[model samples]
Target: MLENTLAATYTPGVNLKHNVAGANWTFLLPRFALDTIVCYGVPGQKALKTLARISNNLVIVAAEASTQTMPPGVRLHSGPATSLPLPARTVDLIYIATRDAQRLIERDGDACDELARVLKADGFIYTEAGVSAGWLSQQSARLGQAVRYWLTPLLGEAQTAVPEVDAATRRYFVENDLFSSSVRLAAIGFGKRRQPAAEAAGDAANAPLRTGGRSGKRRLRQKLRPLAAALQQAAGRVEGQVHLLGKPLARRGVLIGPEVGPGIPQYLANIAAEAGVDLRGWRWGLAARGEYSSRKVLIFLFPPDEQRPSLIVKMVREAGFNARLENEYRALRWLVENGIGDAATLPQPVFSGYHGGLMLVGETIIDGTPFRAADGVETGELAERGLNWLVELATTTANTGVASAETVAAGLEVLLERYIEIYEPGAGERAFLAEQVDAIRRSRQPFPLVFQHGDPGVWNVIVTPDRRTAFLDWEAAEIHGMPLWDLFYYWRSVAIDVSRRQGVQDALAGFERQFLHESPLNATLSLAIRRVCDATGLSAALVRPLFYLCWMHRALKQATLLPRNQLAQSHYHNLLAFCIEHQDAPALAKLLLAGRAEPQVSG
Candidate 1:
C-alpha cells in the first residue's frame, strides 16, 4: 500500500521514466501457468509483491524490502547475484534492475552468466531503470537515443516486441520542477503486443459512471443516456435486430467513443495476451475513467458463464490516474486489514504493478445489484444503513486526538484554487465562505477525523443477495477525513432522488428537512451521526462547519471534472449555497449541532 502525508500530491514529470517497464518483464514469463521467478535488487519488492500474487514459485535473490515479511508464496533467498543457490534450468525468469545487474557484473564480472545458469531454455532475463541509463547501454555509460529498459536473451531473441513508454504522459510533469526526472521509479514492464484493428465499445457499456460531463442538454436527451448505454452493450453481444438497432441509436453519444476509437475489446484482448491468457469466449466490459480528464480505463474481463466478473484491471493512460488507482489499492488493503473484505461484495486485491507503459491494479469483481440514483433507488432505509456502515468504519479505525484544519484539508490546494477559479465568488458569497473558514479554523481548538469514503453517493453502492450494502468505487477515500460528510453527502444524494427531484428549491428544502425536522428517519440519522462523533471524538460545535466544508470540497472537486457548459448546474453548488445561507440559522443551529449531541426522541 502507498502512503503519503496527504494523498492529493501529484508529481507528473516522473512519467518519462519507466511507465511500461514492469509489463515488459511479465511478458517473458508463462502467460497462464505459475512460473518460478527470481527478483534480484528490485527497488521496493514491487516486482516481488506482484509476482507473489500470480506465481506460486518465486525465489527472491535480493530486494530492498528484505526486512519486511514475505507473502506466503515468496521465498527470500539470500546470496549475491554471482552465486548459485538454485538448480540449473529450473528458473523461468530472472528480474534484475539495471543498477543491480551493473553492480553484480562489476563485483564478480559474471552476474549475467550466473543469472543465466538457473534459466531454462525458454527463460529470459529482464532489466529496467530510469531513462538516465542510456539506450541499450552499449558501453555502459554513454547515450544512444533514449530508452526505458534493456533485455538480455540467454537462449535467443525476445519473444515479443519491446514496449514503448508513454510519451503523452510527459504533459503532466512540470518542466521546471526541480525533482523532474530526478527520482528513479521501478516498475515491472510487459512486452508490447501487435496493435490489431480497433472500434470503441466502452462508452456504450459504462457511460453513466464512466464519463462525467453536462447532463443531457435537453430533457429527452437526459432521459436517453441510459438507453444509449444499454444500446452500446446490446450491440456488442446480440445479433439480428438488437445489434443492428443498437449500433445506430447509440452512435451519437452513448456509443460515442466506441465507433471511431480503438477497439476496446481488441485493446483488452491485447492486454490479456500480454498477461498470457487464452481469452476466448470471454465477455469483456470497459469503463473509461473520465471523458476528458483521464484516460484511465477499468477493463472488466468476464467469463463466458456471465457471473459478476472474474477480473477488473484499473489501467492508466495518463499520469493522474495512477494516484487515484494507487489510492484505491491502498484503501482496499486498509479495508482488508480492518476486516471489511468479504468476497461477495468487495474487490479483493489481485495485482498492483505496471503493464504496457501504464500502472494497473487487478482485483476480483463485486457481485450485486447496483444502487444508482438514475435507477430511482431512493430509500430512507439505505440512508440509515449507509450511516451505520460509516459509523462502523469510523469506530473500527478511530484515532485518539483532534486534527487541525490543515491536516483535514489534506493537500487540497488545487481544490481551493479550483473553487475560487470556477465559482468566481462574488464579495457576498466569498465573505460568507471565508467567514465559515475562519470561524471553524481560527480557534486553536481542533476537530476529530476518521476514514471517509469521500464519494459515498448511491451510485457507488451495491446490494448483495442477503440485502447487505457494499461500496464499490473508493478512489476518493481519505484516511484522515472529517466525519459526517459521508453521511450528509449520502442522504443529500438520496434526497435528490426522493422529495428533491422537483427542482433546486425542493432539493434545498429537503436538505433542511433531513437535518432539522423531527421525523423518525431524521431523528435516527441525527442519533447515528452523534454516536459517530462521540466515537471519533468529534465535537458537536464543529458539525455545522464540517458540513459546509464537505459540500464545498465536493463542489470544487467535481467542478474541475465537469464540462464548461455544465458548471452552473453542478448539484453540489445548490447544496453548498443552501448551507451557506443557513450557516448560522437558529433552527439549523438547534438541529445540526445543538449544545451537545442530545438526541431528540421522535414521538
Candidate 2:
C-alpha cells in the first residue's frame, strides 16, 4: 500500500533541462534518465556534487540516513540505487558511486535490499568504488583501533547487547549478503554493485563498460592520492594547539632564536653585559607561543640598520623548559660543535632524551674591530663547521635527486661514526664488539632505539641561504637500539622519493658512490668494520641465516604496514632474494626436513 501511494504521488521534479513544449526524452535518450539517484557514503560526495550540477534529474540519498530533504526540483527517499522506495520493480535506471560494502553491510543490508527492490528487471545500475579507503571486513588485534571504532558505532546492538533493531542485524550481513561473509575479517568490497538482469546478461560485445572504462575510472580514483596525503599531514594538527607570534629585538647582525629553548633570553642578557652591549638600555622585544604538547617557541625581530636588517628571535622547548637564545653566526658555531658536533660521535649513546640543541651567533666588525665575543665569551668554530659540513653534504644529496635511502644513510653513518669516536671504548674495539654482539644476539632484535631525530628526512634538515644546515622538528628524535636500526629506519624513507628510478637501489648507491668519490679508503674500511661489528653483535656464527632471517622478518612486517608503504615491498623482495641465496641452514637440515622449526644455532 505504501509503495502504491509513493508511485501515485511521485510528481517528477522540475524539468529544467527540457521545459519546452517540443522538448522530449528522445533528445536525452540513451544519455539521460527520468531520475538520477546518487549513492553517497565515505567519499562519494565529490562525484555526487559534480553530477547534480551537470544533470537535470538528480537526487541524493544520504548513505547513513537513507533519506534526504533535497533542494527544490530534486526528489528524496530512502533506498539504494538497486532498490527504490516506489515499488518492487520500479526504478528505470540507478547509479551508485563508490562506497564500502562492509560499511553498507553494517547498515543492515539496506544498501543491498534497496538495490534488489527498486532496480527494474530490465533496467541497469551503474556503480563505482574501490578498496583504497574501505574498512576491514573482520577483526584482529593487529588491525588497530580505528577499524574497531568504525564498526562499533554502526553495528549498534548487533555488535553488543543493545538489541533495538531486527533480531538478525548482526548475522544478516555475514550469513547471506553477497558483499560480506566473515566475522574477525571476511572481505573488503570497495565498490561492488548488482546490475539488473539485462545489464548482467548482456553479451560481451554489447557491454557498456567494454570501452576500457575500468582503467579510466581507476585513473580518476588515483586523483585522490594527493587528498589522502593532505589528510595524513593534517592529522597531526588535529591533536595539538599551535600558536605563532612576532618579536622584535634591539640589535642588528643578530640571528636571534632559542638555542636550548625559551629561557635563553636570560643567558643572552648575561652575554650582552659581558660584551659591553647595554641591552639593559636597549629596547628589544620578544614574542612567544606554544603548541599544546608543551613545545613553546619564540620569535623576535630586530631594529633595521644600515649593515644588517631586523633580527628574528626564536625559541625551542627542551627538557621541560622553554630554552631561549639568539642566532649569532659565532654562537651557531659553538652550538654546532659542542652541542651538535661533539654529540655526533658514533656509539656515543645519546643521553637518551637529550635531543641535540642548536645555538646561533653572529660576528661583525664594530668600529674597525672584529667582534669575537658574545655575552663576553669565546666561540668555537672547528667542531661546529665540521658537523655543519656533513649536514650540508647530506642536504645536497637529498635535493640533487639522490634517493632518500642514500641521503639518510649518509647522515646515519656520519652520526654513528661520530658517536664511536666520542665514546672511545676503554677496551680494544674487538673485545667491546664481541660483548655487544653476544648481548644483542641473545635477545630479540631490539626495536630502533638510539636517540636520534625520530624523522630524519630531508625537509626536517632545513638549510639556510648562507649554506648552513639547521635541523628542525627535533621533536621526533628518539632512542632505537642499534646503529643499523637507525640506518634501517632511515631507509624506510625512500617512499618519499618515489619518482626516482630504482629508488631504493639508487638511494643505497648514493651513500656508496659519495664515499667512493670523496673518501674511497674510508668507505671501504667502514663497510668492512660494520660487517665485523654487526656479526659480533648478532653472535649468530653463520652470517647467512642470521642476515636472511633478520631482513626477512623486517620485510614481512614492514611490507604489509598500514597506509601501504611501497618502499618496503621493494626492499623486502630484494633482501629476501639476497637472504635466500646467502642462507646456510643446512646445519639445521633436521629442523627443516622434519618441519621442527627452531632457531639455527650460532657460535
Candidate 3:
C-alpha cells in the first residue's frame, strides 16, 4: 500500500517540493498548503533541469558552493544557509540540496534558525539527497564513497518503498543535524553496505605489490612504550586497586584499575563529603561495558531513581570533577597559559601523551552527566571521543532544529578561539599558514604526519542521550610537525561530511585559525624549535632531523599504508619534501611526478 502510494502519485516529474507525496497540495498554488520550498546547491543548469521536470512553483534557493568548475547552468548566490539572505515568516517549506552541510548547519543550526526566520507558523519541509550509499558503492574502490552523495541514493530508494519515508528519513536528517531540512536523497536500490572489491584479479595486479622498509621501529616503539607503562603500573608505581568485578550487567566482569577504581570511590566520597552525608552504603550497579578503546568491563550505575545532588554544591562538585575530566586540556592549557604552546614555552619537557578507555556515567540531565577523568583513556581515545561527541551533539542539535554544520562549526570555533587566545599566532607565520589551506582537503593531511584521528570524521564523535559532547579514541592522536596539521585533516573530514549532504564547500572558512591555535605543535613552532635546537646546540641528535624525518616517515607510511592512489600518495610525498628536502624546485617537482597515476584500472 505504501509502495502504491508512491508509485501512483509521486511520479518522476511530479512537484512534491512543498506538498507531501500523497497529498493534493500542489506546490504550484501560491496560497496552497505548500507555500514555500528552499533548494540549495542549485546552479542555472540544475535548476533548469529540475524545474523542467516538476510543475511546482518552487523558488530555487542557492547556498554556497565551490562554483569554480560549475557547469554553465549553476550560478552563484549572495547568501549562505547558515546566515541566509532571506526574510522572516515568508515560506512554508525549505529544501537544501547543497554540499557543505557543516558550514550551513553551523551557520544556522540545521537551518532551524533559518526556518524559524523564514517559514510560516505551521510550515513543513521535504528533502531528497543528490547521492546516497548505494551510488557510492558503485564507484571506484580506492576513491571510496564520497560522503556528499551517499545520502542521496538512500533517500531515492526509500521514497520507492514508503511514500511516507519522509518522516523516517527526515527524522534521521534532523538527528544527524544535516544542513537542509528539505532535501533530495539518492539511493542505490536495496544494496548491502559493501567493503572494497579487489582490483581486476589477474596478471596486471601482480606488479609485485611494493612494501616500505619498516615501521618495525615505530611499531616497536608503540609496543614498547605501552608495555613500559603497563609494566610500571603493574609494579605499583601507579596507585589503585584491581578486582575482576564481574560484568556490570553481563558475564564480563570489570577489572577495576587504579585509574577508574580510586576515582569512583573518591567521586562518590566527594559527593558524600560535600553533602555532609555518608555514601558508604549507597548502592549502585556496574554495566558490563567497555569504552571505545578497550575490552574491559566498566562500573556503570544509575543514581537512585530519585537521588539527585544538592544544587549549590552541585556546580562546584561538577566543576571540580569536570576539571579533572578536562585534564588533557588543563595540562595543555597550562603550557599555553604560560605561553608554552608558543615558541617561548618550548624545551619545557614537551609531554606527548593521551588518555583512553573512557568509562562514562551519564543520565538524561545536562548537569548530572558523568565522565571518566582518571581511568587510563589514552589521548587518542580522548581526541576521538571528543571529536565524535561534538559531531553527534551537532547532529542532535540539527535534529532539534537547533544544530547545523555552522552551529557545530561555531561550537568548534568557540573552542578554537579559546585555544588561539591561549597561544596567539605570530603575524608572519599566520600568513604563511593561511596559504597552505586548500579549497578542498580531506581531514587526512597531505603532510602525512601521524594519522592521529584528529577529526575522527563524524561517526567517531559522540553525543550523550542528553545534548553533551564527548570524544572517543584519544589514543589515536599523535604529534605532527606541520602547523594546522589537524586543519587539513579536519577539513578533509568536513569535505567528506558535506559531500554526503548536498555538495562540497569549505568547512574551514572561519574555523582554520582555531585549529592553528589548538595544535600544541605547528609548523611555526616546529620551525622555531628547530632553530632553537640548532642555536642551543641541543645534543639530542633526533631533535632537528627528527622534525623533517617525521614528515618523511609519515609520507612513506601514507604511500605504503593507504590504498594505492597516486594523488593521495603523491600529495603526502610532496608535503613531506616541502618540510624535509632542501633540494631545488625541480627536484620537488620531480617527486610530485614520481608517482603519477598510470590509470591501471577502469570502472
Candidate 4:
C-alpha cells in the first residue's frame, strides 16, 4: 500500500512551478533531470499547490503550519531556517525567496551551512535581493558582520564577506567542500575569476566524507583556503583606496565646480587688473542656467558696479579639449588685436589664462539673449551679420595657404573608403561614390584658404536686444579651410533644429524649396554664397561639388563621433538619398550608378 501511494504522488509528465516575491520560478528550471527539489519559505498555499504538480519528489519548508487546505502529494517541513530536518547531500536543488533568505542569513549564522549539508555536490541554491546605492562601502559592513558571525562556527574558521554591487542588486552562489564539511559563498560582481581544469578535478576528488579520520587536519586547512583568498582580495581593494586618497583632490584635466577654492576669485581679479579693468565693486557667482555638453562651463557673473562695466567670467573644464583650448585662446587674442567686431558682435576679452588645468576667459558680457529663429526680422539680421562676420574673418585670415584640389579630393576619398569599410555599401553604390570622388579630384579649381569656424551653428549665435548678432564657442576654429564649411554647417543646423521643433516633413519641404531657389529665407543663403565667391574669385562650378563634399565630410564625422545616435544615423541615410536623387551632378551620378550594381564584397 505504501509503494502504491508513492507511485500515485509522482506522475510521469507534470512539471513543478512556483512564484514568490515578484520572481518567477518557471524561468529558473534546470536543464538536467532532478529527482528531488526543495523550496524554503514557501509564501502561500497557491505556491505549494503549484509545486505539487511535479511528477517527481517535491518538498516545501514553511515557517509555520498554513491554515489553508494542504495540497496532496507534497512533503512539508515546519522549522527554523538554521536547522533543517533533511539528510546530508540528499537534495538536488534549493530555492529561497530573496527576502526570506536575507532574514534567515541575518538571524541564523549557520543557516547557509545547514542548507549546504543537505545539498549534493553539484546542487544550486538561488536567491536575489535588491540593494540600495552606495551599498558597496556603506551597506557591506552590516552584511559582512552577519556573514562573519554566523558562518564561523560551521566552517571552523572566520570568514570575511565581500559585498559586491552589480546591476543595482546582489547575488550569492554556494559551493560546498563536503570533505571538509565547509561551504564557500562566491559573491560575484565587478570582477571575474578563472579556475584551471586540473585544479577543479583535484578539488572534486578530494571532497570530505561524513566520517572524520587522520586527514581531518588536511580537511581543516582546505576549508580555510577560501577564507584566506577572500581576505587577500579585500586587502588589495583597501590598498587601492589608500593610494587614491593620498593623491591631490584635483582631477587631471577637468575642474570640479564644488572643489574650486577661494583663491580663484583673487586670481581673476589679478588678470583683470593687468588688462586695465577694475573689479573693485563686482562680485562673482555661477550662472543660473546652461545647456549640457562635453565641457563643463561655469559662467561667473560680475554685476555692473559704479567703478566699471559688467563682465562675464567663463571657466571651461574640458579633458577632451585641452589642446583645443590653447588654439581657442590664440584665436580670441587674434580677434581682439585685429578688431574683428564691436562689443555688439563679439564679447571683448579682458583676460584669458589657465587655472587648475581649466581654461578660463574673462570678457565683457554682451547684453543679449539666445537667437530665436521664429523672429523673422531678427533672423534676417542674424544671417546678414553672420555673413558679414564670415567675410571679415576670411579677408583677415586670407594669408593662410589654400589646400590644393588634389589634397581635398584625397581626403574625401579616404573618408569614402572608411565609410565603405564601416558600413559596407553595395558594389554599385561604392563604385558610384568612388567615381564621384575621382571627379572631385580631377576637377581642379584654385581657391584661397581662409579661417573657418568649424562649428558655426545657430546655437553658437546670440542676438542682442539691439538686433546685433554675437558669435560664441570658437574652440573649434580652424586657421584655414574652405570658406563654405561654416556657412553650410550653420544652415544645416538651422534646418535640423527647425525640423525637430516643427514636423520633419513640413520643415524638409520648406528647406527643399529654399535649396531649389523656389523660396527666399534669410536674405537667400545661395545668393550670399555667390557674393562670397565673387569676392574671393572662386569658380561658380566649384560650389555644387564642394558643397556636397562638405556635407559628406560632416555626415561621416557625425557617424564616427556619435555612432549610436539615432539622429546622426538618420542624417547619414538622408544624405545618401539626396546623392541618389541628384544623379545629374557628376559625383552624385557616379554614386547612384554604383549603388544600382550588385555588392562586390560582404561585410
423-464: candidate 4 lDDT, tens digit per residue = 566787677677656665664455556677666766677777
Q: Put down candidate 3 lDDT per residue, 29-102, tens digits, no spaces.
A: 11222334545545234333333233233555554454434433333444655555556776554444444442
Q: Is candidate 1 or candidate 3 better by lDDT?
A: 1
Off by over 4 Å in 3: 1-456, 460-472, 477-481, 503-603
TM-score for each model: 0.53, 0.25, 0.22, 0.48
Query: Total clashing residue pairs per candidate?
Result: 17, 62, 94, 10
lDDT (10s digit) by residue, model 2, range 173-253: 112111110121101322211110101111111111111246555444334434443553353232111100101110111
Give candidate 2 misplaced runs (Cα > 4 Å).
1-298, 301-451, 464-470, 478-482, 498-603
TM-score of 1: 0.53
Error of 1 at 537 (Å): 1.2
Report each candidate's C-alpha RMSD, comma-separated, in the order given: 17.3, 27.6, 28.3, 27.0
- Models ranked on TM-score: 1, 4, 2, 3
Error of 2 at 256 (Å): 26
Deviating ranges (above 4 Å) for candidate 4: 1-281, 288-293, 303-309, 373-381, 414-437, 496-510, 560-573, 583-603
lDDT of the candidates, in the order given: 0.51, 0.28, 0.28, 0.46
Report how far residue 108 has shifted in candidate 4, in Å. 32
Candidate 3 RMSD to the correct structure: 28.3
Instruction: Give the local distance difference test score of model 3.
Output: 0.28
